[model samples]
Target: MKLITVIFSVFVLSPLTVSAAPQTTSGEIRFIGQIVDSACEVGRAGTLSSSESRQIELKPGLKLDVDTYRNACSHDALPMTMTFEPLKTSTDKGIVTITYL
Candidate 1:
């Protein structure tokens, strides 16, 4: 279970407030249960430069769907590598690679 996370933030100052969003950059977001860990390899990781820091915090709650990785059903259907549109209307794309046991 992996999710491409789009982080957003908000700030408040005595009833006046400002909002900020996570700068979106193309990257490979890996999902494990409810956690979306960022890539931490040497120099081959995805883009995080355009990603902006946040001012406000949010409840950590987003789970990548295993069903979202399901391939199209058909008689001759092969194991498929597929991705989907992001949830909460922000994610542009998602991809899933299936591994059998």
Candidate 2:
């Protein structure tokens, strides 16, 4: 399967060892992910430019549902033109396209 690169920026609060409280900084941050389609780009991409970053948190063992992509892309079909037709899977009923090198 082919994969695409995704990037994200994050901001977080710094912990203090003294009697002072934690502080947040607007600095360079980054995240990376491999996605199969475009819907994943729109749903998962974000910037740490505002208060939204303060409420966002990252955790280990994250999983994404395929239905999220189907729903988001339902209304907007990506424009494509191929010589051969796409094949649908018998099990999960997914549309698969083949490319040749």
Candidate 3:
């Protein structure tokens, strides 16, 4: 009878002791990004300056016209053409063309 009781106690207590043991999980997380030219905000008359760094969010269909002075600001303003195309996923494909003029 004592042997049976001891066997039963061991079977039940073994699981409890095993479950109480500490568990550890390890992995790695990485972040990737890029540093690009800041956006230049134009004036009310639609003008941009070399000193200004403005950020603009482009949607599917939007157009903008901007004019800037030559080497007026620390950051010389440059003309760029950006085209956004929709892809199969939620992300979009952007095509950027920079012109010296």
Top lDDT hit: 3
Error of 2 at 91 (Å): 29
Please, what is the TM-score per model?
A: 0.14, 0.16, 0.25
**Total residue pair clashes for candidate 3:** 2
Clash count for candidate 1 is 3
Per-residue C-alpha lDDT of model 3 across residues 2-70, encoded as one tens digit per residue? 999999999999999976666443755444456344343443223444433444345644344343333
Residue 20 in candidate 3, Cα distance off native in Å: 0.5
Candidate 2 backbone clash number: 0
Model 2 alpha-carbon drift over 4 Å, by segment:
1-32, 36-73, 85-101
| lDDT (Cα, tens digit) per residue for candidate 1, span 1-101 | 12322222222342343223233348754443552333221111232232322111111232232221222322333333333335565664333333332
Worst 10 residues of 1 by lDDT: 39-48
lDDT (CA) per prediction: 0.29, 0.29, 0.48
Worst 10 residues of 2 by lDDT: 50-59
- Name model 1 segments beyond 4 Å from true: 1-79, 91-101
The true-versus-predicted C-alpha distance at residue 85 of model 1, in Å, is 2.8
